[model samples]
Target: MHDATEATTTPKSDDELKELVSLARLVAYARENARDLNAEFSAYCLDLAFGALIQDLDRSGVSLSHESGQDSSLFGTRH
Candidate 1:
């Protein structure tokens, strides 16, 4: 989860990028697959925005998914 207190200027870590992409995909899937056009459009916009985030992370060499490892649970760790 993002918080107002967290420094927004710092680059996201690999873990953060992975989690962010996962969440973006989840939201896009749920919203885009809905019966309403409004929902689909909202999902499209969200997907577009998240795509930029993905590209930025990609440029930094962060992968969207792990091939062979346990995925970290955000709730399991605390800053």
Candidate 2:
């Protein structure tokens, strides 16, 4: 999990790119498979927005940590 306050202004690493790709794939899958038009459109818009953010982050070289701490309680257990 990323702690926004702990983020640094550094270039995104290969690991970070991989993580973002994974997230994008999940979002894309939802957008492509959703039956409801509203849900599909919402996911499509979200994907577009997220893509823009990624581009901006790449240009700005922002480093966002993808570490998962002992804070699974926020959204229940991962599994």
Clashing residue pairs for model 1: none
Query: Per-prediction TM-score, please?
Result: 0.41, 0.43
Q: What is the C-alpha local distance difference test score of candidate 2? A: 0.50
Indicate which candidate wins on lDDT. 1
**TM-score of model 2 (CA atoms):** 0.43
- Candidate with best TM-score: 2
What TM-score should be assigned to candidate 1?
0.41
- Candidate 2 lDDT over residue span 1-79, tens digit each: 8565444445567787667555644544554445345676677686675455445444545433223331122213321
Write candidate 1's Cα lDDT for 13-66 as tens digits: 868777766775564455445424567667677666656555555555655432
User: Number of clashing residue pairs in every model?
Assistant: 0, 2
Candidate 2: residue pairs that collide? 1-67, 10-61
